[model samples]
Target: MYKHALAAAAAAAFIHLPSTAAEVVTQWNFNSLPADGATGTGTTAAAIGSGTASLVGGATASFASGDASGGSSDPASGDDSGWNLTTFAAQGTGSGTRGAQFAVSTAGFENLVISFDLRHSNTSARHELLQISLDGISFSDFALFDADAGGDRWYTGRTVDLSAVAGASDNASFAFRVVSAFAPTTGQYAATGVGSSYGTSGTWRMDMVTLSGTAIAPVPEPGAMALLLAGLGVIGTVVRRRA
Candidate 1:
């Protein structure tokens, strides 16, 4: 009976092994840290962790209000800013070519997830594609989003689950992009707003861009290992005496 109890306790310890919780690896809030009280002024540097944010395919970027057009998901009450992008490809040209890109190393992490808030202008492309790159050079489409709602509205919580992409975890070159794309089954881009035409001058405002993952637990230290071995030895001695 004592031997059985000891075996049961060992099994319980393995069964209850602690799990790592998901946490934000990197985040781009875009709002100034000191609250400058000006919506037109903000920083592109990540507000949490380290990463790089850049425009892609000749797009121009500026700071814009995250609170405009019904506001974004940002919790900031005042001086909230978002990364605004424009100079998209000409109508019916360069689909999935113009937008923003972000690079963040996922070293020592797994089960990656990406999320953000976006606001579409009236004449912006209705379809947007989320692309991922393991090598940070070539990208592949992972998901597509449609701003079906009328323009000047915030589309919060645009998320992509990359847990199944094994190469995305523990990778130093992981990167992603959100770009305008042609409407599904159509060769041309559709307007975000009804009764409007797609145009290159339209803007996309992004806020609360974040990457998250579960941290890989570190190996036990030498002292911890020694203690564990000593405990196991004690247990074996106890078991032998009981026998």
Candidate 2:
């Protein structure tokens, strides 16, 4: 009875253990504003982020905003192609820049969840995309194009849903990211000057980019089934010995 009781507890602790949803390994904010707004705390800045226009050559992205004076990050003049590192920025919120992008490194992730806030300060700030990947080599697309990319303008807080991208997988190690860019570059707007960048006169901002989730390789459960199998093997050996 005592042995069985101990086994029960062991099984409960391991198999039924409470799970903690994975959370941010790291995060950043470009809102360089001081923890407390005070005089001489550094003003005249964009109070948002490094709104520079470039490609994701290969560099890590920070969600929190900071002083633009030394704010911008690397992969600077190049593009964002390297793995693991990524960038999320759309051109002019209300002005002549319209774009967005999603990227990720599949090597370090399997099952994961990524969340972030965005400011569609203008017409060109909307995006309808969420990128999901497993093994970084295989990826799935979650297109939100049917809905307004950035949602209603003047709207400052919005999150991209990755379920569409993940599709169907009980659990898999993976990373989820976003992709957006200045579109409407052609068509009637091509000659008429109606491209997305030319839509209005503003810019957008991203805050709180977080990646959290567990690598989802199946783990064997230590339970009665396992113990029973072991016992059955032992019994079979004994019968063979007797024979």
Candidate 2, residue 225: how far the Cα is off, in Å: 7.7
- Model 2 lDDT tens row, 148-229: 4332222223344343444323333444444443334422111111233423233334444444444444455678558756
The residue-by-residue lDDT of candidate 1 on 1-243, one tens digit each, is 978699668545533354689999999989998889999999999999999999999999999999999899999978999999999998778888899999999999999999999999999888899999999999999999999888989999999999999799999999999999999888899999999998899999999999999987767778876776776776777789889
- Residue ranges of candidate 1 with Cα displaced over 4 Å: 1-19, 219-230, 235-243
For candidate 1, list the clashing residue pairs, or say none: none
**lDDT: worst 10-residue window of model 2:** 75-84
TM-score of each: 0.87, 0.42
Q: State each model's C-alpha RMSD to the native.
A: 4.2, 11.4
Q: Could you tally the backbone clashes for each prediction?
A: 0, 53
Best by lDDT: 1
Candidate 1, run of 10 with poorest lDDT: 10-19
